[model samples]
Target: MARPRKPLLSRARIVAAAAALVDAEGLEAVSTRRLAAGLGVSGPSLYNHFRTKDEILEAVADAVSAQVDLSMFDESDARDWRTALHDWALSYRAALTDHPNIVPVLARGPGRRPAGLRVADAVFGAMVRAGWPPAQATYIGALMRYFITGSALGSFARGFVDDETAYDPADYPHLGQAHLLAERREKVDEGAFETGLRALLDGLALQYAAVVPDAHAAAGTER
Candidate 1:
C-alpha cells in the first residue's frame, strides 16, 4: 500500500506513533516495523530520527511523563511538601492510568528522559526543601511511586470475578459476596488511594517534623 502524504517523518512523529501503537496494542507490539507502518513511513526512515527502537521508546516514556502535573511542586508551593507530594502522586497515577501499557517502563526509572527528569527534580527538590533528609526524601519518592503504580495495576476494590458461584462459600466465607462490591469498585479504589495517601503523608509529616524541628518552628507550619 502507498503511504499517505503528510508531514515529513521526524522524531516527534516517530515517538508519537510508537506511543499510539503501544496504547492500541501493547508494549511488545511497538516494533520498528509497527511504528513505521503507523507513521506511514519506511522502516529505515525511522533511524534518521532514532538509531534504535529503544531510543524511540525512551521518547515515548518521556511523552507520558510530560502529562504528569508536577506543577504542584513549583516555587509557589515548594514548602508545602505534604500537599505538593499528594497532588503529584494523584497526577502521576492519573497520567499512568491513561497509558497503562507504559506504566511498567516508567516505574523501572526514567532513564535520563527530559520530561521524566523534570518530574524527579521537582519531587525530590520539594521534599528536601521542606526539610526531609535527602535519604528519607528519596525513600518517600520511591514509596509514593510504588503505591501509585501498584494502584494503577489493578482494582483493589474489584476482588476476584463478578460471578456469584465463582467461589465456594465452604472454602472461602468472606469472599463469597465479593462481587457485590464490584459495582462500586471505582469508589473503593478512589477511597483507598485517598486514604493511603493521607496516611502516608501524615506519617511522613511526622518524620519531616522530627528531621527539621528548627525549620518547622521558624515557618510555624503545623502540617
Candidate 2:
C-alpha cells in the first residue's frame, strides 16, 4: 500500500488542533492524549512534534500572538509613539479576546515563544525609537501587556445578569440599570476598552512630554 500523501500529523497541525481545543473548551481540556484522538493518531505520535503538553500549549499561545498586527510599529510610517501604542494595544487585545483561554499562558510573558518575543521586541523597540528611555520603554511594554490581557480575561458587562432584579435598588442604589448591561455587552465592553485605551495613551503622553521636552509639540503636529 502507498503511504498517504499528507502526513497524519505535523507540528502545525498539532498546534492548530490544540488551539481549537483551547478556544472551544479552555486550556485545561488540552492533553497529548486528547489531541492525539482529535487528530486521529495515537497519543505517542504527538511526542514526535512536541515533547510535552506544555510545549504544545506554548505553541498555541504563540500562534495567537502571531495574529497581532505589528505594522503600526514600523518606523517608516512615522506615527507618533502614542498612536502606534494605542493601535498596537487594540490589536493585541483583539487577538487575546479571540483566544481568551490562552491569555493565562500569554500573561506569563513571552517566555521563549518566537511570535511572543516579536511582540515584546516591537513594543520596546518602538518606544525607544520614539525617544523613551530604555528602562521606561521596558515598563511600557509590561504595562500594555498587563492592561490588554486583563481586559481580555473576561467581560465586565457580561458579569451582570440580564435579570432586572439582579440589582436591587436597596442593596445597589447606583446600579439601577446594571441589569441592562449584559444585553449591550458588545457596546459596553468596546466602549470600556476604548475609554481605557484613551486614558492610558493620555497618561503616557504626559510622561513622554516629561521625558522628551519637545514631545508635546511633536504630538500636537501629529494630531
Candidate 3:
C-alpha cells in the first residue's frame, strides 16, 4: 500500500491525546497503552515520539503554558510594571484555570519546558527592566507562580457544600451563608482572584517605591 499522507503518530498527536485524557479523566488516567489505543496505533509506536508517559505529560503542561498571553511584557509597551504584572497574573491564572488538571505538573516549576521557561523569563526580565533588583525580580516570578497555581488547584467557593444545612449556625456562626457560595462559584472565585491580584500589586507598588525611589513618579508620568 502507498505511504499514508499523514504520519499515523507524531509528538504533537501524542501530546494532544494525552492532554485530552488528562482533561477528561485527571492525570492518573494517562498511560502509553491507553494513549496508543486512543490513537489507533500499537503501544510501542508512541515510544517513537515520547520515551515515557512522564515526558508526554510534560509536553501537555507546556502546551497549556503556551496559551498564556505575554504581550503585556513587550518592551515597547510603556505600561508600568505594576500594570503589566497585574495583567500577566490575570492571564496566567486564566490559563491555569482552564487546565486545572495539569496545574499539578506545572506547579513543579518550568522544568526545562520551552514555553514555561518563556513565562518565567518574561516575568523576570520585565521586572528587572522596570527597575526591580535582580533578586526581587526572581522573587516576583516565584511568588506569582505560587499564587496562580494555588488558585487553580481548586475552587474555594465550591469547597462549601451546596446544602444550606452544611453550615449550622450553632457550629459555624460566621458561615451563615456559606452554602450560597457554591451556587455563585464563578463570581466568588473570580472576585477573590481579582481582589488578591490587586492587593499583591498594591503591595508590590509600595515596595517598588522603596527600591526605586523615583519609580512611582515615573510610573505616574507614564500613565
Candidate 4:
C-alpha cells in the first residue's frame, strides 16, 4: 500500500494514533509495526520521528498529561492550597479515567516529557508557595501520585455483579444490602474519593500549621 499523506505522518499525528490504540486496546498493542499499520504509514516513516516504540509511548504519556486541568492553581485563590490540591487530585483522576492504559507508564514519572515536568512543577510550586516546607511539598506531590495512580489502576467500585440472591442472609446476616449497594458503585467511588481527599488535606494542614502557623492563621478566616 502507498504511504499515507506526508502531512498525516507528523509526530503529533503518529503519537495521537498510537495513544488512541492504547486507549482502545491495552498498552501491549502499541508496537511500531502495529502503530504504523493503524496510521496507514510505512513503519520506517515512524522511525523518522521516533527511534523506538518506547519513544512513542513517552509521547503518548505526555499527550495524556496535556488533558489534565491545572486551573486549580490558575484560577483559585492561591492561599487555599488545600482546596486547590483537592480540585487538582479530582482532575488528575478524571484525566486518568479517560486514558487509563497510560497510567502505568505515567506512574513511571515524567521522564523527559516537557508537559509532564510542567505538571509536577505546577503542583509542587503551588504547595511550596502556600507555605509547605520544600521536602514536605515534594512528599505531598508523591503522596498524591501514590493514591491517584493506585486508584487509576483499579476500581474499588467495581464489585461483583449485583444479585439479590448472591449473599445468603442466613450465612452473612449483615451483607443483606450488598446486592443493592453494588449497583450504585459509581456513586460509592465518587463519594469515597471526596471523603479521602478531605481527610488527606486535613492531615496535611496540620503539618503546614506546624511550620507556617501564621499562614494557617490567615487561612483560618476562609474556613
Identify the leading candidate in terms of lDDT: 3
Q: lDDT of candidate 1?
A: 0.81
Task: Kindly list the per-residue Cα lDDT of model 2 for residues 132-200, writing each as its tens digit.
Answer: 899999999999988999999899999999998878899999999999999999899989999998888
Q: Write the per-residue lDDT of candidate 1 for residues 1-223, one digit (tens) a residue.
A: 9775788888887888789888888789888987888777788998887999888878898999999997788778544777777778888988987898887788788778999898888888887777778998799878887898888877776776778888788988978777777888877888899899888877777666678887763342333
Count clashing residue pairs in model 4.
Answer: 0
Clashing pairs in 3: none
Tell me the RMSD of model 2 versus the true structure: 1.6
Better of 3 and 4 by lDDT: 3
> How well does candidate 1 match the true structure, expressed as C-alpha RMSD?
3.2
- Residue ranges of candidate 4 with Cα displaced over 4 Å: 1-6, 74-79, 217-223
Residue-level lDDT of model 3, residues 1-223, one tens digit each, is 9998756788989998999899999999999999988888999898888899999999999999999999999999877788888888889888888889999999999999999999999999999998899999999999899889999999999999999888889999999999999999999999999999888877777788788996563572222
**Root-mean-square deviation of candidate 4:** 3.0
How would you encode candidate 4's per-residue C-alpha lDDT over 105-193 as one tens digit per residue?
99999999998898899999887888788998899999998888787886675675588898898998998777876678778877888
- Per-residue lDDT of 182 in model 1: 81
- Local distance difference test, each candidate: 0.81, 0.89, 0.90, 0.83
Candidate 4: Cα lDDT at 34? 90
Question: What value of lDDT does candidate 3 attain over all alpha carbons?
Answer: 0.90
